[model samples]
Target: MASALCCRARSVSSPILSSARIRRRLPLVGAFCVISLGLSNLCPSLSFKTGCAQSLPFVPLFKSKFSSQSQAKSSGSIRMASESNTVPSIVVYVTVPNKEEGKKLAESLVREKLAACVNRVPGIESVYQWQGEVQTDAEELLIIKTRESLLEALKEHVKANHPYDVPEVIALPITGGSTAYLEWLKNSTRD
Candidate 1:
């Protein structure tokens, strides 16, 4: 059945199977295979035969470095969450009108312990709609790094100190980074 499907896929020689078209569709095919494999594991009835993925050259098969328990135990570089005691870190962005306000806000955030570090990036242009009208303004961007636990306090502080009525304050999680830098960020911010 798997070979039949593979043959069918190869035999389809329409214009849609051209080089560029194949490139565009390969990702979708790979995603479908991944989802199919996951579903097959969850429901035994949907399982594909062992060589199904191998038959399709365009579909990528990914193997993790720690595929076996022995390999995982032997590796010293990879530490489990329970072992690391790591805290989640976040990077918050805030845009201000000018350099003066950006500098003031960055200093205040660091001084108040609301953020570990605030980087002031100048010469940014912002265009958005406000009060049913289009508006454009020159702005500076502030990148604040702190613990995820301090997000609410950080937002409140920015709201109070920012010059704009509706300040652009957005936070993005720092998924992974250098352990030393993450530790510094965690220690620098207030609990």
Candidate 2:
């Protein structure tokens, strides 16, 4: 029975499969595995990729959306929330005509956890056209520091509480800045 397995041998044991044999056999196995992975990526039909499936190269069949840098940037400005250093993250510049009202609103936002903190700079002179009327007034400016994610909620809360029929709640993206400060902002504004 042992003699049939060997070309010629008495007490000599056979070496492992040759490198050429391994190379020839592996491609077939690799092809089978690739097909299996590809099949799992396709669902509902051959043409439609499921929500779980994405088109990327030289990576695993599945990867997280957060792992995709392009998606992260396009969704919103990506701030590296580095908690290691001391820096201030995104600070929204808020303008309101009344100092007292502005301070009140800022405090409310911070107390409600919509904002990490708010600082009021009183006595800002502003001139703008409202309802086709050019007007000038002494306005208070609020510097609000918080995470990028909470911008929407902050806007809504500000508008709801602000005295003006239309409030100035704008988010200017922080492209690059101190990483440590950004991290603090991210940490402070969590659900």
Candidate 3:
């Protein structure tokens, strides 16, 4: 086993093996030292790799088990709650085939109070598989900001106005934001 490892190391271009490459071959440096020491007694040539392996420090391959509460208490850190009870406002992303449709949809959503703001991002190129065929087209992307409660109505509005059979309407939650902006976003949307 030691002969094969030594041969593999020697066969490579570099005369001296790097510490990273050595660590990859042998998980524990100490275990490799013991095995190589025993093999060196049988064959004197294996002693060089044993000397090289001992110089590199052992790196932990896995993370240690720890509790967040205990770690916080020890370090004098304040840990925030992982989950909150209040429903947050979110940004809805929608893609339309053209700018006209995008503008119409954006205006309608904001006018209806389904969204507080709608930003039209033009010249978006989309490539996706549709009905078992790969298709590519220039598109306009709408970034709509609104409350979670108005999501159903917003979807219905888009469905009614959208030309495509299956439109891209997806909501992503806003975990946190500027306090004033969040407050304004909440106030601007429908009750």
Candidate 4:
């Protein structure tokens, strides 16, 4: 059965199975060869030459998908998270002393292309310890959306511009959201 599949695979010469397509599908072919033929060893090479699988040790099909180094060595045939076309987005939480400060920071961030959108929530009460005493104060919250890669720059900008000595700059990864909004967020922020 494995030999028949291999023979059929080898005999396939359609225009649809061009070199680029073959390279893109090599992992699937390698997986089929390993599972169907019970082959313990196969080549890591992406070539489709006859008898190539039997000549070398098996290469895990999913390795390159998870490892950047492996993906780099594989000539980028497989796409990883870092190599994705869409930029990874993040949500940042920053608390400001008042609405005036919040607006100031939000405007600056958007104007500088560090943040896509900055939603200001007013009249929030924060209770925290400061200078060996518990303090309570009303604060404004700035919810910022931007690219994950811009986190450090955003944080630095906040630290430099924010009124607080230690400004609240908390970041959270955006797992999923509207595709259009995410794309807009990606486009709004710097690379």
Candidate 5:
């Protein structure tokens, strides 16, 4: 059962990594995931289903339908496992006054290779103080995904293209993700 669980945890149906290849390529991650899975069963409260089961090691246990971490967190999307290591990815969160502007910025980032992917979520209501005045507005959120090294460049690009005098550009490190997806992320963005 433990071996099967490990196999399942690392399973990614890619042409490059068949089940056998995954096990061979990531033996340690697979073993670690299997151990974690066993422990989770022992302690039901230890479950945090972060979509692709980053807790387990060989690879992602599964994938999530949603791509944006901020949106997913806001919606209580999934409960992921807890043992996964932080990957070298960063998620940049930016807010725009409207969806159209958000779309433009998102497209620009991806097109410029500053971001691997950008998820724009509309209808988000934001309330904050700006220039000593309380402000409220319906806003759009842009979740940008890319390698951590691109943060500086991404920030510069956003500052240049963003319409707001001070747009919210926050980033959180990607602690865990599917091995294949992370590889894709690395491949998609500039070094």
Candidate 6:
């Protein structure tokens, strides 16, 4: 029975993953989703239902509708194994002026519990367009890992502290990560 259920989940998961919407957001989300639905999408004949199974690693596929992380968190939008006690799974990469600024920003985020850790990678060369001309500058990058719940506050912290006219505040999702590490990430950043 357990093996059959795994097979069922794999079948439903394959197509649901091939869906048009999920591809763009983050394939990591798709990966977590595969674990969650556990072949539930294979049965389209079943009536559409409400609620989520993110806690069970076998939820209905239709519930994976929203593209934004906020929406996902609100509705049990993502799933993991029963053993999963992972914290949050979002990593935001930001560019700042210098090591001094980077460290300051990192310190602030940690102080506020907005991010677990903000690693300052210095001496990065960035090339981009500004005011109609292409430009290159040596910039420091702040790699911050935190829960999705803390992203908004993190952004606010960055905006207030960063010295750039428009700092790079792009974030990427962590789909399949160390279960223990994820739990640490959540615990470290909690306010």
Give residue 129's lDDT in candidate 6 (0 to 100): 94
Candidate 6 least-lDDT 10 residues: 41-50
TM-score of each: 0.60, 0.52, 0.56, 0.56, 0.58, 0.57
lDDT of 1 by residue, 8-60 (tens): 66678776655555556667876887877655444435567666755665433
Report the backbone clash tally of model 5: 8
Please say which candidate is ahead in lDDT: 3 or 6: 3
Question: How many clashing pairs in candidate 1?
Answer: 0
lDDT tens per residue, model 5, 1-191: 54775477566566665666655657777677666565444443555454555434643433223333444553342223122222378899999989789989999998988888999898999999988999899999999999899999988998999889998989998765565677688778877
RMSD of each: 9.9, 18.1, 12.2, 15.6, 18.0, 15.8
What TM-score does candidate 5 reach? 0.58
**lDDT of each model, Cα atoms only?**
0.77, 0.65, 0.74, 0.77, 0.74, 0.71
Q: Candidate 4 lDDT (Cα, whole model)? A: 0.77
**TM-score (C-alpha, index-matched) for candidate 3:** 0.56
Candidate 2 has which clashing residue pairs, if any?
Answer: 81-183, 87-181
Please report the TM-score between candidate 2 and the true structure: 0.52
Instruction: Look at candidate 4 and give me any clashing residue pairs.
Output: 42-56, 42-57, 42-58
lDDT of 6 by residue, 113-189 (tens): 89888888989999999999999999998899998877788788888888887888998887755666777887888
- Candidate 2 per-residue C-alpha lDDT over 1-191 given as tens digits, one digit per residue, 9 for 90 to 100: 22232323323444565444555666776676566445543321332333423444633643344346444554443344333443334678788878778878888888877777788998789888999999898999998988677778888888888778888777776666556556666666655
Clashes (backbone N, CA, C under 3 Å), per candidate, total 0, 2, 0, 3, 8, 4
lDDT, candidate 5, at 2: 46
Tens-place lDDT digits, model 3, residues 114-175: 98899999999999999899999999999999988889999999999999999999999876
Predictions ranked by TM-score, top down?
1, 5, 6, 4, 3, 2
